[model samples]
Target: MISKQYRLDELAKQVQGEPVGQSDLKLKRLASLENASSDDIAFVNADKFLDLARSSKAGALIVTEQLRAQLQDVHQNFIVVANPYLAFAILTHTFERKHEQRGIESSAYIHPSAMISDSAYIGHFVCIGENCVVGDDTVILSHTKVDDGVEIGKQCFIDSHVTLTGECTLADRVRIHANTVIGGEGFGFAPYQGKWNRIAQLGSVRIGNDVRIGSNCSVDRGALDDTVIEDGVIIDNLVQIAHNVKVGANTAMAAKCGVAGSTVIGKNCVFAGAVGVVGHINIADNVTVTGMSMVTKSISEAGSYSSGTPMLETAQWKRAAIRFKQLADVPLTQFAKKLDHIQAQIESLESTFKLRK
Candidate 1:
């Protein structure tokens, strides 16, 4: 990890922010408003944090024009940007600890048939099986297993304990966190005569460039074709992406999101925490599924979608649950039909009253 310090004006130029205080103030780190000290810089992205920003003892602050106006009375240094949150994000890379690539360890095992670039870093006890190719500047951390025929691209980071098997391929700049199982067997079985039979997973996983998958996620190998995770997709921890699933580019899935087999999710989609997408469905681009929603069918249009009921009081929820069960006996179609008939009767009564008058 590299330690860096930046001047207030220097950091402002990194994010195109306007520094309104002492430009020479040295900032060593970025911290939250509550935790920032005299040398650290903090950010105020929303109104909720304005109070804390006012009282923050930090050397400087990152703020939007609106927030800067609100904090004009406060005695604080300001680095005004168009979007404080975005500025904070850009500045994070400046202060974030980055791994330095070193040569492969002697304890690491690389088969004679494997081709590992000299620039690539293979950590202690890591294993690269036969016919594997690791590209330039790729870092495979300790205890990771790259099975036969697996190919990792340039500048990739495969964290500790990850399993890249079944001839998987990863593009450049991919980051797979610790304990993720890529190209593991898909959950495919046949219901034979009073018995279950396992089906061979003949396909692997193909990850695109700049994809980041979190720890403990299981991206199962396909039964026939490769499971595809497109470019710039970011998946959070504990998510399950089943066999033959194609996650589109720049799509984001939060923690515990599950997509069953053969589901094709569209690009620029957002699946909130715990969202469950069923099998064999296609979700359109720019779609957003809210938290805890269950997607059981295809979405042909781009829009925000949600399912299941929002939380209510226990008593209210119990009554609503009863009403939910009653829908089976009196479906919505029946209710619509009954309402149409009642509307016709009302019109007839109105006409008869006009004739009498």
Candidate 2:
């Protein structure tokens, strides 16, 4: 068990919380309200969780000022803050998994022609190919492979089993999680004599600074131009980014999302999980795509977009789907006939009025 403690006063300043508990009390770890013990710390985002806060076994609770007033009677220690979740995240990081430092292992293979900076740390069984430039303070973990001519910048952490293919360039402070592959060949083919011929992918991937790519993600290299990921981009696990795509700065994509080739995504856009974007489409800046959406066209405006069948009971969804499919075949002639009959009745009434006149 990890038993690291933090001073309440120091944590309050870091998380912008007002401490009501002992300032010197050491907080070892954070936990949920239901699961926390007297030695653990927990947080409340709103008053809806006040009951849990009151009944919690935690030594202290972090809560917003609004919620703190409602919990004045609770005997548990407290810290008041503006955003409890953000504060909890800050505190959680204190006990979160620290990045392991695996110094250069004897079994690792560094090519004679590779220029690795003295400050970089290469882990066990890692391979660095010819003419590769690994910058200062970079850590390439175990079983990873850096192909020839690749350039990785300063303070980058390339996690275990990651493969950086040839000629890929990563900017400073990039963090690539385990088993992610960058700069692989794009899926390009041509038909020749009833057989598919592979097209040589000539372009590389250029990733900007402060990019965080999650585990098991695959980013393909371009066929003609570079696949560009701009600064401060956060990509979730298992995402697939195809060739020649240009993702703008500060954009985020959730897990299992896939963007086809040549698609240009604008800045500050958010894509939820399993959102599939077709090839050659342009998504505007500040766009937010809902989960499970299939984007097939260009979006010129900055707004939220969604498309998909909503969750429904199986029987109800089937009935609705059947009716929707038959809507296009509904007869317009029937409506036209009904309108004609109504018009004839109006004419008859007008004739009777004329006869009276």
Q: State the weakest 10-residue window (summed lDDT) of model 2.
A: 95-104
lDDT of 1 by residue, 1-357 (tens): 444779999999999989987889889999989999888999998999989989988888999988988987884578999898899999998998877867889999999999999899999999999999999999999999999999999999999999999899999999999999999999999998999899999999999999999999999989999999999999999999999999999999999999999999999999999999999999999999999999999999999999999999999999999988988778788899999999999999999999999
Q: For residues 1-357, what per-residue lDDT tens digits would candidate 2 score against the true structure?
A: 557677777778888778886778887778899999877788889878888888888888888777877887875468888889999888876878765553578999999999988888999899999999999889998999999999999999999999999499999999999999999999889999999999999999999999999999999999999999999999999999999999999999999999999999999999999999999989999999999999999999999999988999999999999987786577988868999999999999999999999
**Candidate 2: deviation at residue 64, Å?**
1.7
Looking at model 2, residue 42 earns an lDDT score of 85
Error of 1 at 294 (Å): 1.3
Clashing pairs in 1: none
What TM-score would you give candidate 2 relative to the actual structure? 0.88
All candidates: TM-score: 0.93, 0.88
Show model 1 residue runs off by greater than 4 Å. Answer: 1-3, 331-337
